[model samples]
Structures are given as C-alpha cells and as structure tokens.
Target: MHILNIGILAHVDAGKTSLTERLLFETGVIDRLGSVDEGSTQTDSGEIERRRGITIRTAVASFTLGDLRVNLVDTPGHADFVAEVERALGVLDGAVLVLSAVEGVQPHTRVLMKTLRRLRLPTLIFVNKIDRAGARERELLADIRRRLAPSCVPVNTVTGIGGRAAVTRPVGSTQEAAEILAERDDGLLELLVEGGTPSADLVRAALAGQCGDGVTYPVLFGSAITGQGVPELLDGIGTLLPAVSRSALPDEPARGAVFAIERGPSGEKVAYLRLRAGVLRVRETVVFHRGQNATYDGRLTALSVAGAPAQREAVTGDIVRVWGVPEIRVGDHLGGPGPAGQAHFTPPGLETVVRPRVPGQEPRLHAALLALAEQDPLIGTRTLAGGDTSVLLYGEVQKEVIGETLARDFGVEADFEPSRPVYFERPAGTGEAVEEIQRHGRNTFMATVGLRVDPAPPGSGVDYRREVDLGSLPPAFHRAIEDSVHLALREGPHGRPVTDVVVTLTRTGYSAPESVAADFRGRTPVVLARALRRAGTIVYEPCHRFEAEVPLETFGAVTASLAGAGAELRDTRRRDDTWVLAGEIPAAAVHEVELRLPGLSHGEGVWWSEAAGDRAVRQSTATR
Candidate 1:
C-alpha cells in the first residue's frame, strides 16, 4: 500500500475539521462520526481546543483509502496559529484546501495559497458548504482564480436544488481544463489547434500528473456535513495526489524529521517523527542532529501512530509517535546526518507579562511555561529580573487561551498584564571598551580584552568577529570571550534584546596567575556592557502591516480609528461597495483595533496583520 501524508487547511470556520471527520468516517477509520461542535473529534481532544471550538495545535490522524494509508494532519486556520500551520506544511506530501463557498476567498486563504504555491505542494481545493443558501460555486471559483491562483481547475461541480444536493458532475470536459492541459503539453496544444479531442484517460492523466508538478490545482465541491461528493473527494485523494516515493532501499539507514514535541498521556515527552528512509525500531537508540555540532542520542522505547495501536517498528515513509526521547526538539533530524530544516514562522509581535495568581508559585509557573515553550518554540518565553515571566503572543485570543491552558493543564493559575509591543535595541553610535585583569585587585582571574561596538544595517542582526591575532590569547580564553559576548547582548543597556549591530574583539591578552575559562567568561559581560553603554542604544517598536476591507459607508470611521492608533496609511482603493485600506500600525494598538473593528464596521469588515519588523523611533531611557 502507498503512503499519503496529507494536510487539511483553510480559513477559520471553513469546515476543515468537519471535512477531517467526514474523511475518517467515509474511510471506516472510526466506528462513528465525531462532531466538531460537540468537541468529540479524535484530533482536537484538548480542553482548550474543544472549549474554544478552534484548533490551536496541529492534529494528526490516520485512515485508509483504497489500499493507501493516508496520514492526515489537521491544521489550525486562524492566522493567530500560523506557526502550527507552518510545521504541518513541512511534512505534507499533498494538501486539501477547504473553502467556504458562501464567503469565497478570505485573507488567510490568500496567505495559505501563496505558501502552498511557494512550497510547490500539490493541492486539491474543497469548496465546502455548498448546501448553504447563498453558496455559489461558480462565483467562488472565479474569485479563487482571480485572488488565490490561476492554475486552479475544477474536477467536480456542485448542482444544488433548493438548498439541497441535486447532483455533482465529474468535470472532465471543460474548456478550462483543455486550455490548461494544452498550455502545459505541446502535443495537447497541437492536437487542440488541429481540432482533435483528447480521450478521457489522456485528460485525466494529464490533470493528475500536472498537479504534482505544482502548476495545476484541482477543485472539488461538497458539503462535508452532508457527505456530498465525499466519495469523489476520496477518489481524488487516492488517485490525483502523489504518494510518498519509495526511493530508499530497505537497507538504507533510518532517517526522519521531528515536526512536533508534545507530552504524552503519561506526562512524558513524545517526539512526533516522520521517517523518510529505513525503519525505526523499538528499544533502538536514535541520533538527533541539530546542526551546531550538537548531537543527542536517545533510545526509542515506544512507537505509535495516530488512531492505531502501538507498534514495535515503523517503516520508511511513515509517521510515528516515539517516546523515551525527552531531549528531542522540534526541527531535530533523527538518524540522518544533515542540517535540520528551518521552521517557517513569524516572530511574535506582541508580548505580555504572565504572573501567578497564587503567591509563591513562581518556580512552578516558570517550569510549566518552559515546558510549553519547548513544545512550541515560537511562544518565546523570557524570565525577567523580577522573576516575572513574559510570553510572546500572536493576539489577544491566543493570550487568553494560553493563560487558560496553563491553569487547566499545569494547575498554575496566572494573570496577564496589558500586552506590550516587543522591541529590539540597536546601537546608535560606535564605541570601544577595554577590560584589564589588573583592574580587579585580589582577584585571581587573569584576562585582558578590548572590544569594539559598531552600528550595522537595520536587518543585519548581531555579528561578532575576531580582529586580534589568534595567538595573542589562549584558545579557551578566546572561546570564553565569544560566549560572554553573546550572553551580554541578550539584554542591552536599554534592557531590550539587541539586534542589527556588530561586536568585534579588537585586543586580547591573558596572564595566568591562576586562570580558568570562567575567569574570561565572567568578566566579559561587564566589559561588553560598558561598550554598549558608550555606543548608546535605541529601541525600535515593531509595526504590524494591515490590509482591511470595510464597507464604503464605514470607511471614514475605520480610517479614523486606525489613525487614532498611530497607523500610517499606505494605500486606499475602492472594491465595489467596500474600501480596501492598506497601512502599517503600531503593534501595541493592534489588540484595541481588533476589538473595535467588528462594531465599527457593523460586522462587515475583514482585516489581517503581519509583523513588519521594527523601526527606530527614539532613545529608550528606561533600564531593567
């Protein structure tokens, strides 16, 4: 049997979970169908996910479709959980993009479609909710072509009669398909020019082949709730989408990527692995490679698949939940010796300080949060000087959800302060600072180092180089200085994370009265701080780039609200009865704007924002 690792994705409330349930039921993977409304989904079993009726984490399930083992990943649709979507994208062989026919293409739909094309993943579009009163497949298709992608070709069309499923035609003979096929193939183009018709087998073969080539997309219409066109959808999954290639011989070494880290039912860390070569066996030690000359070895104690019993081994092209590897992290490569794949995620634009509601629970709260951070590294938690913990968030909803999850999962009641926009510090000028071992009286540490701080371009990030001769200082001492440089930059003079600067060691001298690596490492921070103080630093607040669609009558009010929030309007255009406003706004004001948008536009507005990096405004006088 072939293995198909697929992902179901879409905008929020587009029936992605509903479609997942339907697929599982149709394939006989479940004894009964589970409803998302009731929170009975096999994948969305988390308390927070069920309570909010939204998927915050990616969920996996398995099913069989015509002798094919389909490993399905159900991903969150809300833009707030884009990190979850990104992780799922890395392991998918194909995707099913669910769309609400009534709403057509949305902001997130466009975002996801762009990523799908960028990754060159074969995608099948499911126009869900066709049974609704105002669902128009034709108009939706046109909108998809104009806004999403031009390569979308319809494979099935819905014929609704009085809000009921009338029929669905297998759309084989169409001018659009013929044109797309002809454009891709010279023989088909020549035959079409000569007024020759291609057979059904030839057309189907061309369509299926081009889908995996990333140039063609297949569209299928159905109501997942009513099971309309689900069989055809299954057929499409089995036949249209490409399966994982069995290129690795059985004798090849084991290889896989860790896409997720989660605590299993027994409260132990479980590494969700996707094996691409060889086999993973129980009790066998696996090597994890994370690139920086870092490698960890852990034994696989147990292996299990979604919706399946525990297995002693998992073969090539399979996903398994492996236990006994507590050190495994997201993006770690197992068995194979190669650089870990980078996760595509935007940095958190908003940050909030989380405090324990109960007194003296700081340690527990910190440990719980640290564990959560390990599972979702994008969360970005930090420990402040006052022992308060700050967590980076995507939005207010995510903040609330994270707070609730902490209380429920870890029993740590917490409260969050008003969110602050995360800022980065950069050097405004260049200066040098020198530290001499003789300056410290009665101290045995013997090291002398001179470092220079220089300004770099906005996005250049922090860089360190050695300007002094190699033999001037012992290699251990030099290594300690380099390590201390990185630690010192974590919190700059302004108490913000530093970026866009270059720090170079200009001079190095060490006299060992009785010295160790710690001597050089310990004193390096003081010298680096002195240099940063002399160089001076500026704080830059992140800005969120926004695109809003508001009714024409509410345009003035919407623009006024945005202006009140320190937004800089970049462009404005009219789209039928609505106005499309594009601009950048202070990240600090995003939560306020989001709260007021629905009321301001009378629920007829749509807006989305993404991090626009940071721009320097003024010097930060505040210090931590």
Candidate 2:
C-alpha cells in the first residue's frame, strides 16, 4: 500500500460528500460517517461550504488503509467553484470522479474529465447512489466511456440496487475481467489471446500506464449511505492511487506561487502555494511577488500540514499554510522553502471587471475587492469606466460567496451588476477606411490609414498585425501604431472597449511630414481612431453552454424559457423523473433566465447553470 493524493469530484448533489463520509467511517478513519445534509461531515468543514451542500473549497484529510496513506481532497462539484478543483488538482496524483448510477454522465462530469486529461492524471470512477430510482449501471458506464476517457471500465458492481445490495469485483480474473482487459495493453491483448489471466498488479500497472498516457481510466460503483462496497473502494484506492508522503519541494530556496489565499475568522491569511522548484523553510525570509525576485522580503511565519499546525517546511507535494506575509497574492511567486514553477490560475470565462453597488463605499469597497482579487489573482479586476468596476470570477456562487465574505468579513454589503464581457468585433469583409487626425494645434495632424477588419474564429481572442512590413516603415514609427491600437481597443471606436473582432493596419501616413513628429506617434491614435470609425463594428455578448436539472414535466417549460432568452438549445432529456436541459445562452441573459425557470415551470425546476465562454467570430459594436 502507498500514500495517495486523491480528489473526490462529481456533479452537484451526486453523493460525493456521502461517498467520502462512507470511506472515512468504514476504513476506521472515523468512528461514524456524518451526513452532509445534516451539516456534520468532516470534509465539508466551512459553514458556507456545508450550508451550500457543496464543497466550496478543497479539504485535505489523512486516512490509513492497511499500509497506505490516503490524503483525500473533497472538492466542489459545481462549475462556478471550479477554481477549487483546479487548485486541488495541482496537488493530486489521482482522482475519484463520483457519478450517480441513477443519473449518468453530466456536464460538470465532462468538465472534470477534461481537467483531468489536461492534468494527465490517473483516474477511478465511482457510480454511486445506485439504490436511487432510475439506476442503470450499464448505460451510465457506456456514457462515461464515451464522454470521458475510453479506458473506463467498471471493476465493481452492486449485486442488488441500493441498501440491501452486496458489492462484487466484476473484473475478477481471466474470464471475468475480459470487459476491462480488451484494450488495456498489448500484453493484455496477448494474455487474452492465450486465454490467460493477468494478475491484479498487471491490471493496476496497465491502468496507471494508460492514465499516464491519457489513454484509460479504472471505474467502480457503490451506494455510500448503505456502506456497500466501502471496503472494496478503499482497497482499490490503496492499490491504485499514487503516494503523497514523499512529494516535497526540493531542499533549497524555491519559487512557490499562490493559487488560492483564504482568510479565516481570526484574521489570519492562509496562502496555498505550489512549490515551483525550491524548498521553503520555516522562519525564513522570502519574496512575496513574482516580479520582485531580487528582493525576498516576507518571512515564513509557520507551516501546517493536513489541517494541523506544524513548524516543518513545505515542498512540492505539500500544500501548506504560510502566515505573517503581507501583499502575497494568488499569482505571486515566492522563494524561500522551495522553488515552484510560474503558473497563473486564471479562472475560465472571467468577465474582467467587478463593480460595487454601495454608495460612497467606492474607495473602501474597491480596496477590499482589489485585495480579494490579489489573493486569488484569477479574480481579475479592471475599471472600464470612471465610476464602474468589474470583478472577474469563474462562477456565480463565487460571486455570492465573495459578496457574503465582503459583507461578513469586510463589513461591506456590495451587490454586483451585470458584466459586459469583452469581445473583439470586426467587419465581415475587408475595406479601406480613412479619418483625419486633427490635433487642433500649430500643425493639423490629418491622417489617412488603410485598415482592414476580418472575422476570427470563436475564442481565438484579439490579434492585431501590421500587413505592411515593419522594415518598410521606420522602426519607431511602426511601434507607435501598435501602442495606440491597444489604447483604442481598451477605449473602443465609439469610446467603449471593443469585443469580438480583429483590427489590422494595412497602411498609415500623416497628412504631411511636418504634421508628424517625423515618427508615427504623431498619427498613430488618430489613424487608429480613423479606421475604427470607418470600419464597421458589431456587438457580440458572451455565450455559455448551460445544463439545467428540473422536474420531468418542466422540460417543455425549460426549453421554452431558454428559447425565449435567445439561447440555442442542445439537448433536453429525462433522467429518472428529472429533466436535464442543455443549451447555450448569452452570458448577460443567463442570470435572469436561471432565476425565472423554476418559477415559470411552476416550482418544478431546481435550476443551476454552467457557462463556457462562446464568443462570436465577428460583429459590429452595439451602441454603448
């Protein structure tokens, strides 16, 4: 047996917390398995995390199984709280993606699998809550194989559904394990040809290997509440998961960057750092910023592991607590105990701005929000207008949590406003546009520039290239054009930041040589602003793929509501007695649509949304 850094992930309310509880109790790690519904589980430690019935943050706990040490991270299953999972994965070697046998592959499930693939991690699947109505192991297993890695195979199955059932290791031997061994390895295929059974070690090795290659995954199932298959699940965990005990930073000064920073009620800041490539020792002075490498100015007050306070230093595999550091941030790299790679935790689909709703609390509110953004640098903050601010986040629950944290932790009750997502809009066809730059001065700076705007693919982001070779123009002159285009994009054509388009410069020259400073700086912005006004611009709001679970009868209403909101429907199907609606909606319309579905469906839908950014290739800017 060996130690493993494993994470428990799943769709919201798919019995993930229950499964973790069962593992703790049955493995003798805990005397009793507490209920999440009752707000008594060990892993759902925070009050906010518990009350939400979701793991808002990652929690690490240690358990012993035979000779193996299981360092488990119970993570949030919701998409908005995905940053929690990302930071958690940085510290994990393996994962347990729990699904409901009653409700198969879900959207969040897909997100987790993609994240796992991106991380190139070993994985085990658990189809829990089989006792629930509409349970279908075979169908769900097939869906898992299709949506996730093809290597997924159920190693265990419940002999009976739910509470009274016994667990059986379906992949037992040569004949029994055929379903799992077919595509495992070349040796496995040979063993099958010879009618031989590979040892359990061989299977584990093959799975680990395939996982390392991004090829396969091992899956199992059970009902966590009845304690069914609990021991076998624990056995599999000890057998297959990787060790975390020896995972430490190198034994010297290292760069550790913050992925998450949390403040407890006691006003202590806990920075979660990934040791990039060095060792951090206790009571050592370290740098708290990525750019200020020459100056290591913060002290390592203390280090803690597995939720307990300790004086020992931290290393790579160790995600420890470091206190007494001010101005430390989520993306800031630190050098002290260990060195860490430079990594930025940019939460996906960020709106790039955060605004406060309180009056006269602007500066204080802005200050606190900025601090929060600094702590979790993924929460990008920017001011698009003089009095308007935007705080970027991965999900709405985070928005709520952040608001609540501000209210409770910082004494500011700030409400959020709808964000205008950024898009780079361009014209569909190419054309030359001209404008005269008249700096009403001694010399009028009239400018004529050939500009072409073209449509780009969704999510390619904005790109500005000079079709005219830099060598054709003065070096300093060409650079000036690039600088001002940035300024123009930041403050759009009509004076609003542009979205969903690409702006390219074909040619530019001043009205006369004396009209310019002999450099393009004299005509850059004027030329840029000219082409921008002449080149047509269109508007594109942020789009998101959404999934909603509601009562069976509400499917039609959900579809209707989504269609009315200008969303493109993907799939609407029934899961047991519940309806799952899949579709794409403009980001601005989601909040309203999400709030109205349940009421519109006559209180039948328990709505939740997961939006992936869908930007248009090109569009003209709408009036601001």
Best by TM-score: 1
Instruction: Residues 334-398, candidate 2: write the lDDT tens digits.
Output: 65322342222222454634445667877877788887776556666666568666776665667
Q: Best candidate per lDDT, number? A: 1
Q: Candidate 2: TM-score?
A: 0.77
lDDT per residue as tens, model 1, 1-624? 578899999999999998999998888888788888899987787988887788888888999866688999999988788888887887889999999888778777888898898888999999888888888877788899998888788988877622776457788576668787778888879888998888777877888998987778988988888888788899989989999753447577888888888887779998887888887788998788875446999998888865356656787778888889888888778875554334355567799999999999999999999998877877888898789999998778888888888999999999999998887788989989997776457754577778999999766667788898888877778889988898889899878888778999987777665667887887788888999999998888888878899999998899999999989999999988999998889889988998899999999889888665666665433454
Q: lDDT of candidate 2 vs native?
A: 0.67
Clashes of 2: 46
At residue 143, candidate 2 shows an lDDT of: 85
How many clashes in each structure? 0, 46
